[model samples]
Target: MPAEPLATVVGLLRDKFDLALPETSTELWHGHPVWLDDDLPVAGFKAYPTFVTVLFWRGQAITDHSGKLNASGSAEMSEYKLKSVDDFDSDLFDVWLQQVRELEAA
Candidate 1:
């Protein structure tokens, strides 16, 4: 994807994350933006050549009724790939973010 559209997607995701996870610290881990709860990664986003992948460290545990999150790797991680800003659903992301924070807390 083009840089402009990708930047827009990144901006949208980052904005929502900042709003939803005010208590978590934000940082660039392995070159990607990650939100950490007490130094443990709870959620993050990686920009790829084709899309931006939003990831939840304990995503498999989240009750994602929307079913947009796909299992990533062989762990509790889950992800949603966005090719554009329109692919992002703020409401769904907020729900998932809340669940992920809860998982991290536990």
Candidate 2:
């Protein structure tokens, strides 16, 4: 489980994420919080001792001109690290969220 502060951050981000994609539902996959669009995994969040990791399943396909999302291990995945609630970039995140929804719909 995450610490109190981290849990709060998780809650805040989760709420915003859910609001962005109102069609998505929350689920637990491998004990981490995952957001699914019509049963397809679209995004997920995992908390760590020092940071929280947010991932987009098809993030590599996103055209993130802001350069916020990091190129992670897989060729199809992209991620962002948030150390605190303040680090949560709502504008950039919303852009990515909309892109993911569009990609999934396509």
Candidate 3:
């Protein structure tokens, strides 16, 4: 489990995403929490000194209609930086999660 507020955020994310992708598995990857599709990493979260970052491994391919992803000029990855759980947007996150699953399936 994560520490304090992070745990709350993680719980919310897990609950929401698990319902959408029942087969997804979560584990610590390089000390960061990650949701996996079989052996492939679909999404992950890392707690930084400045903020918590949620990562989409193949996010570059997914169209963010909400324009929430922080591009940071990365090619195959994108991330959302949140200072707290209140910054987490469930609807937008779901759209990204669904798109990633479809991309992985393809």
lDDT values for all models:
0.88, 0.87, 0.79
Tell me the tens digit of each residue's lDDT in model 1 across 1-106: 3387888899988899999888999999988899998898889999987799999988899998988899999989999999887898888888898887677667
Off by over 4 Å in 3: 1-4, 72-75
User: What is the C-alpha lDDT profile of model 3 across 1-106, one tens digit per residue?
Assistant: 5576777787777677677666788888888778788778888877765467788888888899878787644468888887778888888888888898898888
Model 2 poorest ten-residue lDDT run: 66-75
Candidate 2: where are CA atoms >4 Å away? none
Candidates' TM-scores? 0.92, 0.89, 0.81
Cα RMSD (Å) between model 3 and the true structure? 2.2
Residue-wise lDDT of candidate 2 within 29-65, one digit each (tens)? 9889899988988899889998999999899999999
Q: Candidate 3, 65: how far from true, in Å?
A: 1.6
RMSD of each: 1.6, 1.5, 2.2
Instruction: Tell me the deviation in Å of residue 105 in model 1.
Output: 2.8
Could you give the candidate ranking by lDDT, starting with the highest?
A: 1, 2, 3
What value of lDDT does candidate 1 attain over all alpha carbons?
Answer: 0.88
